[model samples]
Target: MAATVFAAQGASVAAVSTTVPAVKEHLGLSATATTVLIVAVALSAGAGSFAGSAAIRRSGPVAAMRGAVLTSAIALLLIGWAPEQATVTAGYLLFGLALGGIDVSANTRATAVEHHYGRSIFASFYAAWSAGGVTAALLTAGTARLGWPPAATLTAQAALVLLLALTLRAHPLPAAPPDPATATGTPPIDLGRGLWIRLAPFGVVLLVAYVVDSTVSAWSTVYLHQTLAAALSAAPLAYAAYQVGTVTGRSCADHLVRRAGPAAVIRIATLLTAAALAGMAAAPGWPYAVLAAGCVGLGVSALAPLCLASAGRLRPGAAEAVLARLNVFNYLGVITGGAASGILGSAGHFRLAYAVPSALVLVLLLTARSFAPAQGVGGGVARTSPDW
Candidate 1:
């Protein structure tokens, strides 16, 4: 709920920020400035993730999450009242830091919960996140339509986040015992144990998935506007469709994992994603394009949580550290995805953006073996018995 609050608030800010010509004008910026803002946001988000991971290592997940939520609320309020572009950017940087901490802490907590429950729960947790994004987008859109001031909308979101934080007082799950073999009186993770070697292949899959996800989130609307000549009001529906697919896919991810296992599920999902990307690239009309994009969303939906689950299985005690390392690559993919889309769109080759991810999906299929079940069910800490 706290994450939802932050997402909603951020969305409100985005809606207002894009429409407020005065905000950009005050900074003497152009359309290109928006691109820079996005890059800055991604970079800040990555830094936040890095810092959040470190904090999680020091303080437990619950404390880290609380701090994250409080800090984010303050940052949102600052952004709401900022008097200059520099202040606004600083606000965003703080927001990014908060979001990063919240993200890692929450995922760590969720993973620990799943391990305790002995089932797959990451999908459901992520579904809540997707729902939060959808809710935020809708709320922002509605506020814009209602002619609410940007500051007012953002302030409303901040208030809700503050309220939500008050209810999250539970302690985090217990940390896993340190492996004497891997421990050196420091963190549990063994970088020398070919950890990245185990993580990299799956990380590549996550990179491709994030690239496609980011591209659609950041560019689908613009693509529809320029390529299909869609109405300004209708362009956002393309993104909406993608989110809907993501929500749907996440809703069903556990079932798919249980029925087919992770390796098979990932293989099928990669193929599905590739096909969806192709359809998106080849679509001749807006309807077809939206359909393809939604398919892409559906196909890639479970990749992140599943990949994180796999990473958890690889090194049970060091899941947080493993995820932190993978997150670096994941954020890099987001940055490159957005930049690649912008560059391609500028060159009148926007279709190539989709094509690039399709190729990556193929590579994912070829490297599927690296993520084969390593004695675990749903990538939880425990190993799965062959009879079961």
Candidate 2:
């Protein structure tokens, strides 16, 4: 049930991301305006993450999920039907708020489930997220192929999000004692103290991963259409392919960790992602770009869930608070990636945008050693691989 809600939010993300090009075209937004629109969502989402953490402390993940999911649907409707820049930008901000809330709550729930199982199962939740992205991206492509306007396409997606929001239900998980701070009506963890030092490594990895992610997810469609000369109906294929790659990589991530260890996996995947990004930047045609995007997804997919899992490990008892703060890096990466890519794409320098991340991603290598596998509930860290 938790994973399902998470996936639905993923669909929401894809719905917004894959339609960015259409959104720009429909409203006749200038490049700078488009960049601002993307940055607004990222900034708002960061704020929403803090709001979500507070809500989770007050109500619980289920209530937070319900509210966020509903907000996402409304945001989609507002964006799709809006006739002007002001209204559309407002909708994007609303969507960002929902996205951030869903993110913190969903990961909080997922980490609880992982602890209950006493295994490193975080990737599966992310795999579900990628699966949802694939579905929505393909849906966008299908609708575009059928000559549906962006408004109509987003409306259809809004319906789907509304359906998911309705289906969300609370389920029982392993019961744990309430946080002492929550009982006292105080903050869950002191974000200002030693927490940031412990979280810095995972946060760095997360920031880098999201930079790659937002760049591709937010701009790949536009890149294909403008730089690679793809048709409107085909522009979303790159996003779909990228999601498919993430699905594949995340599906195999846990098993790979059990076999190869997280550090080794991160090392190899980081290198692969860099190579893939370079390929994507240099692709001469949309088809090649689509294939390269998939490769980029495959390489980058495992990093995020692993980062979240590792960050949770640092403060298992306060996973929600930790994850919420960690989201600061996530949205920072989004703003950096989305705004930079949009600005560069506007200037016919899209290739440089993608290429820059290829090198920036190598910084992940410095952080790879930090991805220690989850020490299952009662089980100590896996003995097969030495802790980095």
Which number leads on lDDT? Answer: 2
Candidate lDDT scores, in order, read 0.66, 0.86
Q: After superposition, how far is residue 362 of candidate 1 from its true place, in Å?
A: 2.6
Task: Note the residue pairs that clash in candidate 2.
Answer: none
**Where is the poorest 10-residue window by lDDT in model 1?**
176-185
Please name the candidate that would achieve the greatest TM-score relative to the true structure.
Answer: 2
Query: How many clashes does the backbone of model 2 have?
Result: 0
**TM-score for all models, in order of appearance:** 0.82, 0.94
Residues 290-383 of candidate 1: C-alpha lDDT, one tens digit per residue:
8987798788888887887777656556556777778876777777887787678656777887888787777788767666552344333543
1-388 per-residue lDDT for model 2 (tens digits):
7777877887899999999889888899898898899999999999999999888889877788789989998999999999999999899999999999999888888766666556788899899899888988999999999989989999988888787777777765634333311122445565558889888888998999999999999999999999989998899999999999999999999888878889988998899999999999999999999999999999999999988988876666677889998999999999999998999999999999999999999998998777775445324332231100
Cα deviation at 86, candidate 2, in Å, is: 0.6
In model 1, the Cα lDDT at residue 120 comes to 66
Q: What's the TM for model 2? A: 0.94
* Candidate 1 RMSD to the real structure: 5.1
In angstroms, the error of model 1 at 297 is 1.6
